[model samples]
Target: MLIWRLQKRVLNFVHVPPPHCGVDIVDAIYKCLKECGLKNKVFTVSMDNASYNHSCLRFLREIFSRNRRLLCKGKLFHVRCCAHILNLLVQDGLGEIGHIIENVRESVKYINQYEARKQTFSKIVQQLQLGTKKLVIIDFPTRWNSTFQMLLCALKFKDVFPRFQGRKPNYDYLSTPEEWKNVEKVCEVLEVFNVVTNIIFDSDYPTSNFYLSEIYRVKEILNLKAMDESDFIRRMVGKMKGKFDKYWGECNLLMVVASVMDPRCKLRLAEMFFPKIYSEAETRNNIEQVRGDLYQLYMSM
Candidate 1:
């Protein structure tokens, strides 16, 4: 899903996993990197959890428990996943919106069950599809997307929901307008994919993480005022709400926190946030002096 080939050009990175082939995938990734001759050019590591750290001391100590050989060489950082913090914020938010959340979850279960409803769903997509049969399913690792999709599905099914009461839409159930609403929400996500994609690469904002655009996207979903938004936005939001924010926010937060915790942000962030710092220097001779002075000023802050 990393469309930009971040590993290929990213020089540095962070990884977080609740273990869907986490350790092994990380190893295979790096091994492939070595075969591709990237081992020495980029710094990479598997960011461990609280248990992985509390059972030990210091970053190296925690990481060493996983790969003993890394104790001597190789680079790494063991830090918390920042995006999960946001997921916690959302999960805890259910207490504030429990009814809405439960409704959304039920709607998602309805849509994802089987092909007939899905076919009806596909028909709706064809009607509103603009021009494509291909659509991304609201997936798990994409918690934010799921969260958005859920609410959308619930809203889409609002009309028929009264009929079912508690019957629950089974996989073979025929699609309803409510369900179609949810399907459109998925399309909405596709609509904004490019805008959100830009935030990650624009290098022009105060914040560049994917979630920044995501926050804006969610706000748009929550607040869009098209007449019969239920016919449009709510369904889209339900379809996407599930894991969209949760996963992206979880993963992205880790990256931000890693950047913050690196102790290198002072040096690196300056170069990134202030391009002039590099381009406007008086002389090459003063580069290190300027870098040191800037770093010191940052440290004091």
Candidate 2:
């Protein structure tokens, strides 16, 4: 995919052969750029945080620099995929509640497998007078956001589940009362992630400046929930916070630069919020660094 002049489009669809290593990826990318006569026009590459991608960038930077086409010595050449990072964070949290998700997922699958079961579940929904028209969703294991949606939808029809279980007499995946309570709390926590994920994935506009603020909101949620009275919530949030720090504890320089460039934020956002995420001394140093980087980038351009 390529983004040029605010327009995004796929420039090549090369088939990567077995052992898609960094050299192979760079070969494919270089071939495409050469064919398009764009070898010297490239600015940056946005990719997921895969280890091989780092290798790919290193090779590409060397090639571009040898040709004297690398801007700012390729300091801003790699942009980590934000959506992918968000997925890792949520998946970390979900790992702590796998059993609860499995039970809900299995219950949904059982209900969806046969027409008779679907009809019976529908009838139970009617009898219980559940005020929702949404059905239980069977989420795939790979997509954590789908799991979030499945849990959110299932919670709406949670009362109908017991009624359906009573009729079947053989159903085994219905969550216990305490488990249901946990699911509700987890759903509340995941709602913020869901909303921010949507905002990040929005394709109608450029979202770079929006990232730092959304990420800050997520940190606030994790820190607040990590101190909750419920041991379950606290434990779950602890795992999530660990993952969050692994990826985002230190500010990503590119993201901070973008935030500083936004007229609305423009240093003030960093000044106002850095203290919340970092110690006073670190915040002061970080703000100064970002300010200096901003000026250096402008001068280089």
Candidate 3:
């Protein structure tokens, strides 16, 4: 479900995530909207009845109350995310875990709540500085929490957490064997999303970062060329070859998945998930020799 926000000719979209940062279409829409105008595009606001907070109705209520003009169906609108609805089924019986999870969550939170403890912990960490960086910062702190939690509950206070002996429970009682496994899953999914977010935040993150190091993992998995194809796809893809095998196939299936944050060309980029060449591809004199049959198909067509 989505909140289809419109203000005169200007439209704004926003979302809350579930079933894993799931609103992945807005990327393609933003990319596509430029060449084509968005005046004719129809909006579907993602919604879910189970989530009363971020629902389409709540979105409408908030906006329409602020400005009656938004009430018009021709302009701003709201819809629910089907994936969220599907997730209701996925999390159904598991709702009981929320309270239990919260209890454990608070237990972990208690440690981080005190600044002195956090500082002491940081000092301890600096002593163990195996990496140049102390933490991996993410938009969502789930992984960070898990890492910190294990450090606190299990490993930290083992013989009194201050001892800092081993890796287990080093976070606290927060991360469990179960949570560690889930953390891996969250990392995998979040890693894909972080890549997508980078592409979506192209203006901010810049494609240059993507040309270097593990940062290229997303571009490699998404098999995306910059909106301008500024990066070397063949070379970058070669470098990131096996690093992305985990999410590569999934991205091929879900390139259309983007956020409602920027819907411009996301849909069109979704089309690029397949091998179709853009009509505007520059044709070089050497195209015939380099492309052979591929060139023949284009020329014949």
Candidate 4:
């Protein structure tokens, strides 16, 4: 397990025994913080959405709740990693059209795996004078961002594929025109998620304040795409929305406070978007709740 400080610098990489139960993780974390003399200074621990990690965080929160130095009474101490949540959202959407994606994957692999076929595709690219020098990229199934990137690069070779098909009579892996259209739609939707992931995962920057706005943007984009006329996009958005709601339906107060504290946003940001995201009564109540929480946080500090 790796611990990171406020400046995004690695504090420690602790080696723990295997089996990775919640108890094991909590013990590892506790020892690390104690050795570093930062046990009581810990405000939050960001982690991926693994069941074991959730349990580990709950255990840690229970410990921190008794510490006088900690704020929020440890309530906001377990932050679900935003990048991981974005990954889950994209992966859920991709599941709806797995066959189509697999066909594209196979087609990209067929072209890039053999020297002769790769050279043939290169010649086609040269003849067509495509702007990019990037060849077809095959994505790992586990990483949805890579899949988005693969579709993006493959879409650039759309015209070259038909010509390549004529040269290789046995090339049955070629994506059909409709499949290409679906890939295009998928790319458009995933692009938003990809951008947000990049922003959140920037190692050199503080991304906490940006989290609320980026998440709000993602929800807005998905909601708009959910209303699209195409059935494929609508269905995909339905699945994506389920994952989104599971993770983000209730905005985390820590993230809300972070955004509210940003000089660029502050409370105005919440006031401007609350009505669109919640009912009038809910928005009013949320604003009051956030105000109270913010006051509590300030008093604690």
Clashes of 1: 38
Per-residue C-alpha lDDT of model 4 across residues 163-235, encoded as one tens digit per residue:
9999998888778898899889898899898888888786575778887788888988998999998898898
lDDT of 1 by residue, 51-126 (tens): 5443332433434445533311322334334344334433443333344344445544565566554555545556
Question: Please, what are the lDDT tens digits per residue for candidate 2 over residues 1-301?
Answer: 7554567778989999977799999999999999999998888888987878989998998998899755445667877788888888888888888888899999999888888888888887777777664375889888987998899889888888888898898889989989999998899889999989888786677778878888889999999899888887888888889988887777677777778778788878777778988888888888887777677788867
- Provide the TM-score for each candidate, comma-separated: 0.35, 0.92, 0.31, 0.93
Candidate 4 global CA lDDT score: 0.84
How many clashes does the backbone of model 3 have?
59
Looking at candidate 1, what is the lDDT of residue 301?
A: 45
Taken over the whole model, the C-alpha lDDT of each candidate is 0.42, 0.84, 0.35, 0.84
Counting clashing residue pairs in each candidate, in order, gives: 38, 0, 59, 0
**lDDT at 31 for candidate 1?**
58
Give the Å error, residue 219, model 4: 0.6
Q: Which ten residues in a row have the lowest lDDT in candidate 3?
A: 252-261
lDDT of 2 at 47: 91
